[model samples]
Target: MNKKKLIVVENAIKEIAKRDGVTVEFVKMQMKIAMMNGVRSTDSKAKSFWDNISGKGKILTPEELIIHTSELVKQRKSQE
Candidate 1:
């Protein structure tokens, strides 16, 4: 992550720790749990996405497939 984003996350953790009267370590642990949950959710969504696309009964023409593939590539590149 970038420095500014890291600073924002650090500040958030500090605020949470202060509000809950907990140690920074405790806040960090909770953040870790939340991050792990997010990772799991992403993994599940990716699996479901592939499953939905994979079992499609209709076949595409070569041109159609190329267009679809290009669109997917563009989408992935934009996210990066």
Candidate 2:
């Protein structure tokens, strides 16, 4: 992690340790498990995303996909 994020995580762990009357090591272990679960969830989502997009069933050519993506960006900007 970057320095800023590391500091934030450390601060959070410290708070949790204080509130729960647990050692910093124990809080760190719980944080590690949470981070691992988050990584797994993100990996699963990305795999599903690729599986949906990478097949003969996907009809858009590269150029068409670019155009569609640009249109979606514009729509999002308008909504914002």
Candidate 3:
């Protein structure tokens, strides 16, 4: 990850860890598992959606998903 994204992810992980009473490493592992599951999903739409956001043959990181979603929300609000 780039410096900015790394910082954002670190802060987010720390907050999640504190609220959940878990270590930052645990949060990171969960995120990796979730991403891997998404990438390995058999459902066509699920796979396609991931491919769309992550690009073909690429795995999407937590931050990338957040960034994509934030951009989408901003676009929708601008259209309102």
Candidate 4:
């Protein structure tokens, strides 16, 4: 992983475990599993996942990532 991503995941491990009352290793493991799921979704049957827009498996542009992140923010707000 890049340094920035490494830092993000490390901090995420801390934060998620603290919030969930789990061990850091368990949070890290679940995070790794989620990432693997994304990769597997990409590799199998050309499914759309974190890196893609649709099943044909085209990589998402930065704009798409921003739009998706914004949607996630709105969705989370609605849940509360």
Candidate 5:
């Protein structure tokens, strides 16, 4: 994973854990669940990976968020 995304996820986990005063492991598990819930890309392999890791019955990651966002932006600009 990229540094920025790694930081985002790590910070998110920490922030949530701190707010609830939960353990780091609990935050990590919650993050895995959130990621699975958020996965929405079309790549089956990616989906599978996310699903397996998250235990959320999904296979996607927020890491792809920026990647797909830029792709859509490029596509729209091309059409315009």
Candidate 6:
């Protein structure tokens, strides 16, 4: 990840942790669990979407997911 994006994600996670009275590690674990469940769920659309970004047989780490999502959002905004 680029330095700016990394900083942004770190700051965001820190903010979430502060707001929720939890540690950053706790926030990261929850994110990982949520992503894992979403990818493993029976929803074909969700699976397909993640497969496109993450690859068919690969699971992304929470940091990778956040980076990919940030890139996607940046792409969409540029297109708009």
- Give lDDT per model, in order: 0.56, 0.56, 0.81, 0.57, 0.62, 0.88
Which one is best on lDDT? 6
Question: Order the candidates by TM-score, highest first — what do you get?
Answer: 6, 3, 1, 4, 5, 2
Candidate 5 lDDT by residue in tens digits, 1-80: 56875676667667778999998788666655765454665678767655555545534344454344455679999999
| Model 5 ranges with Cα > 4 A deviation | 31-80
Report each candidate's C-alpha RMSD, comma-separated, in the order given: 14.5, 13.0, 2.2, 7.7, 7.6, 1.4
Poorly placed runs, candidate 4 (over 4 Å): 1-9, 42-80
Candidate scoring better on lDDT of 4 and 6 = 6
TM-score of 3: 0.76
Regions more than 4 Å wrong, model 3? 1-6
| Candidate 5 total steric clashes | 4
Which of the two, 4 or 6, has more TM-score?
6
lDDT of 2 by residue, 1-80 (tens): 24564565567667888999998888766655653444345587744543444442344333333344456679999999
User: By how many angstroms RMSD does model 3 differ from the true structure?
Assistant: 2.2
On a 0 to 1 TM-score scale, where does candidate 1 land against the true structure? Answer: 0.43
- What's model 5's TM-score? 0.40
Best candidate, TM-score: 6
Candidate 5: C-alpha RMSD after superposition: 7.6
lDDT by residue (1-80, candidate 4, tens digit) is: 24564565457558878999999888656655655566566365434445454234444333333355556779999999
* Candidate 3 C-alpha error for residue 72, in Å: 2.5
Which ranges in model 6 have alpha carbons more than 4 Å from their true place? Answer: none
How do the residues 1-80 of candidate 6 rate in per-residue lDDT, one tens digit apiece?
Answer: 67787788888899999999999999999998898888897999998888898898788877778899888999999999
Per-candidate TM equals: 0.43, 0.39, 0.76, 0.41, 0.40, 0.86
Off by over 4 Å in 1: 37-43, 46-80
Candidate 2 deviant stretches above 4 angstroms: 33-80
